[model samples]
Target: MQRILDRLLDIFPAADRSFILLRESHSQKLIPVGVKQRHGEQDPNEELALSQSIIKEVFTNKRSILSVDAMDDDRFSQQASIINLSIRSMMCSPLLVGDELLGLIQVETNESEQQFMPEDLQVLTGLSSQVAIAVKNAQLNEEIEAETARRTSLQRYFSPKFVDMLMSGDVTTALSGKTYLGTILFADIIGFTAMSEAMAPADVLAKLNRYLTIIQKLIYENDGNVDKVNGDGIMAFWGVPHSDKSDEANAVYTALQMQRHLWSFNLDLQAENQPPIHMGIGLNTGDFVAGNIGSEDKIEFTLIGDHVNLASRIEHLSGRNQVLISEATWQPIKHLVSAVQLPPFMVKGKSTPITIYSIRGMESHEQNGYIMALPCHILDENGRHLGRGILTDSTPLSNGLCLRLSTHMEIERETVLTLQVETVEYHQPLVCVVKVNSALKGAHGGGSSYTKVVLTLMQEHNEDMIEFLRPGSCVATNYTWNDLKRR
Candidate 1:
């Protein structure tokens, strides 16, 4: 029956038809998506409307209409189109899906004298029902496809719960990456040389995997991405990926969880007659390149820069079950965790001794880490310019989302931002790096602010900067934080 209706509508001469959806007996509505017109003068179309109206009026009367003598009829003579195309006869039928009153269908001709046969209306009614069913199915298919696309996007990066939040229109994670400031946290296991030797090869692999599983979970629970994992060391930057002013809080929370988790694991190892573990963790606040690398065929979403390396160095110096953090990390995370001052020690190949901290506590009470009270600047390729604001504050990073500078600089919208924010890495005289947070924007700043910008290292700050930052420094651009947040 449906197929028959389809063919009949396919041959219907009317240029347009109304497909009705019967939602309720009293609430029938016609969804007007489109219309078809006969390939002739405009007059015939007007006549067609008149003819359709007559057919529809008779539908509720339960009367089949097949009057072929159309144009000369008194009922249609008053219609403006009567003398236009000289349309004569027409037929109309009730379109139904089962017992439901779907709609009405009509066919018309330009010949003024030919009368429609009763059989014509029957054929049209049959075809109209098929049309209604096809339309309904097509609409349903469209809705399904749209829903599938949404699910695919959410599942690609976030957990089911987070994705649900996104579907509900929460765009907190959508903060675009530009240039900003915040803290970076790096962690690594201590003495892999001796630790690996103490166990069988297979045992080492299994143990390492187990450690990573817990570590990754803790980091994710605190809303930070693992960033990058190398051997036993991990470089996790806060204030980006997923962001807000409280990103520092998240980083601190993650560190606290890791500390507790490590403590628990150490106890378990003791009970199992295994050796306890030691670790090094370095936290710094700075800017670095964070993004996607490689060809489209293959790509890695991660952070890369001198800041990333400095974090590893700090981690390398940390000891068993201890978190060795830098002063920069202390700046933002101190409030969230119980940090103890460690005696300053000089790193290899440096005259200055780095002040370190011992991360000893977790945050039972939630709070923010850093504030935007510090003086800030937004620089660009053309030198310094005022950007949006003082870059007053920033969030800690885990999604790899970088912080952004306030709009205060005079930089070109196309210009890249080379920031001079403080970093918490191993501050070597020749090698210093900051984890990046945001992109460059236009603005202006000078005097002490511009001087604070570390153009380079030569025992003293470089008066003329040779160091330049590129757009890849944006955390959001490289890592696809969108996916990470969903995860």
Candidate 2:
């Protein structure tokens, strides 16, 4: 740009000053890109006002102007700058391409003895057209460079596939405010606040990065796009910018694999004499608005809606090293995985409670087994309090059920006991008799030791109760119990 301005000055030697002022696209300010004075130095950063009559006239009319005495010109006679500069003869031409005005070039002669003429205006007019093409090309190159930098920066937070979609211009059209049926997964490091408090900031970041890297790799392997990373937690989703029928199954499998990976990671931590880290995963499947949201200068591609909020809330309810899933997500993949239904708990911003499940593992074959945690009151034949336990799993087809009991009472096989179970379908508790089949230590560790007992339902189990216990049968929907009450 400087070289071009220098040649223009050479072509018009009689002019005492020559400069190229370019209009900024963002601020709409005219900035001096190149400035040359015949005898004095010029400030390249100086800004020129759009109110200057000679420059404004050329810019507004998109034509060349030749004023023999600018001070005497009726249009600029009262203009302060022209009068302060002490009576000038000037010529200016608009840098234009088609209907777009980019800027203007101005040349001034302070000496009244050397005035601009019509032929001088014609020469500058021809040169202004060439300058306009050059300026347009420069702007194009600048925009291309900026776009490349933006894509490179986005790669730090997004997957290569996602960034490619953004660069291809397909996401803008396909995902903008569109509702997509997808699975959202939220994973958070358990006890992160306490862990950070004990460790140095640098160590915390290092360990957090290692954990996030493990999570992000698994998500990508399962065809999920990371929405955002919030400190020690990450939110990712599947089936956006595209869709697959197996999105729900993919999400469940991803959560299972993440747990497996964490087990191996803990082994490494144990070897290094560092405390093992635990994580909680929550997943839900529903419709969400997926798109770029924000203003012109800043935007983000993510999912938003009640679906997303519910998923985060469910994640907060999960326990360490546990993967919890909503009923919506479990319905499709119920047969492929084993989960113990937990008691319905109330969630914030919700009028009624939601049922959640703690995933046990993936079921290998067709089995009639159901895992659940339901409060129950066990009594001896004489109506005496025998124990209180939680029903963990049941297999009515096999005539067997599993319970994690609080009491260590001496109970043997064939021991008759009356069990009262709670139900949402009826006001009365479902009553039945059962014989203890076996007893074993609880598989999970932590608080008081629980005795896991196997029992056989002595009476004919109600088909409705058995059906409700089956996987995919008792999952909750978006409609809360409150909505049911209103109806």
Candidate 3:
């Protein structure tokens, strides 16, 4: 900053004088642009007076204004606008840092008819860009320092990014209703109720937030959001607020990663004679309602729905330091992970059993896996779905049911599916795909690319797997026939 500012005056021929007008997020008037009486020097900080107006202008137009001669430019010819005894030439460069307009820099001279050269304006313009970036960074560093002080004073309650993002007002995507599939993760400190009973509330909160700081950093690294902190438990998600397909895998991976990180975190805690903490994590993936939920007084930018609830239950059932994931999350990632199966347990309020898996290692998981193929599209090496029907196989087991497994690709195909685990007569949870089968393949096909997928069930829990294909029950990836009629 000093180098650039020095160049503003020294690199170019001297005007009368120049100084930066520093206007922060607030308090625009304290050092208002124009003049400041300092050490018997007149207008030592004249740039302060017009800072408020200049900042406002730069933000509105997103460009700089050069007043080669303010006395001639009608906009500032008024005596009230004259913050200093400026008789002739001046140049103002807007201090812009990225999209934000920090403030303005104006150089003035008392010399009459002394025109400010383009070389002067060019130097100021170039320097102003650098100055803007410096100003923004300085402000950010100040905020970071202040925030660190505040957080340290409060005993580290939230991660730096969480506080910064919220303060920046960029949680629009976190709000509900936008559909995205990603891993939802939950972590709970085992025996927290018992621990809380022994410790004071303030001490408990301090310890809890400290532990969360570690967990949150790990989640942030994996591109996940800390949905919210509810007492002893934490809810978080990946791939929304920023979308990515490996969302579920990332969540599951983070869970495993946290367990490893905590080993060190807990070691430090133990050295301090603090209670060692152990946690359990659960991950699930499905269509979830996302948004800013709650009352007028408060809003929660997080996820909701059965998927979130189910993930919580799985976490509760998971042992200390365990990363348990649901079957829905497992299907797409079974190839990428080696999960030891947990005995199926019925979730609360739900009669069906949810098969859970614990990841042991990644090296073995990638070895014994099937190819990833979507319904109507074929995926290439770059993970982009190119052609269609690439999952062709000889053992096409078409029984009218189509397994709606969301792969890294998005395809609409009528491939052979087994309804061994059925949601609808045609809806299969996990389909052993044999080929890239389709009902429509010509230009005359009735359904568009967005057309609802039709899936026929092949199996049910109580009966033979093939009995589901006997008709009556229909599974669809797109829309029902009744919905088509209305369309």
**lDDT for each residue of candidate 3 in 1-487, tens digit (9 for 90 to 100):** 4454445555545465666666657755323333322124454434334434444555578676666666776766665545456546767777777776677676766667667877777877887888778778888899999876765542233335545554555445242456666678899998898888988999899989888887888787766778788988888887564566777766776776676556556646655667777787888888777777776676556677888889888887765556778888888776655455655678896888877775532311332322111223333334443332211011114332222322223434544432222121122333332233454333221111222234443334324323212212212223232432232
Taking the tens digit of each residue's C-alpha lDDT, what string does model 2 give over 1-487? 7787678678877788787888999987787788777787765455543337666777777888888888789988789878877647888888898988898888887887888888988988899999999999999999999988988887666667777887887678332588889999999988899999999999999988988888898888777879999999999998887778888877877786686566556645655567878788899899999987876677777789898999999898776556788989887888766555766778887788887876654532233455443556888889898766666566756767776665557776687887776433234565767788864433331233455678887646455445545554443333334532232
- Candidate 2: RMSD to truth: 13.6
**Global Cα RMSD, each model:** 21.7, 13.6, 17.6
Q: Residue 263 of candidate 2: its Cα lDDT?
A: 55
Candidate 1 per-residue lDDT, tens place, 1-487, comes to 3344344446664422322223333456543223334442334334323443464455566444665665556766566654454556766555555665555554556654445576667666666667667656765697789887987765444434445655665533332223335556787776677989879999887777778778877766665666667777665665543446666666766765675466546545655677767555666556665555666566555566555566666666555445556776666555454444555666665568877665543333443322221122444445544442222222232211123332233323223444443211213111212233333344223211221121112213322111211111111112122321222
Give residue 420's lDDT in candidate 1 (0 to 100). 48
TM-scores, in order shown?
A: 0.44, 0.54, 0.46
How much is 55 displaced in model 3, in angstroms? Answer: 17
Model 3 steric clash total? 30
Query: Which scores better on TM-score, 2 or 3?
Result: 2
Candidate 3 vs. truth: CA RMSD?
17.6
Total residue pair clashes for candidate 2: 0
**Model 3 off-target regions past 4 Å?**
1-32, 35-177, 200-203, 263-275, 294-299, 349-351, 364-487
User: What shift in Å separates residue 245 of candidate 2 from its native position after superposition?
Assistant: 6.7
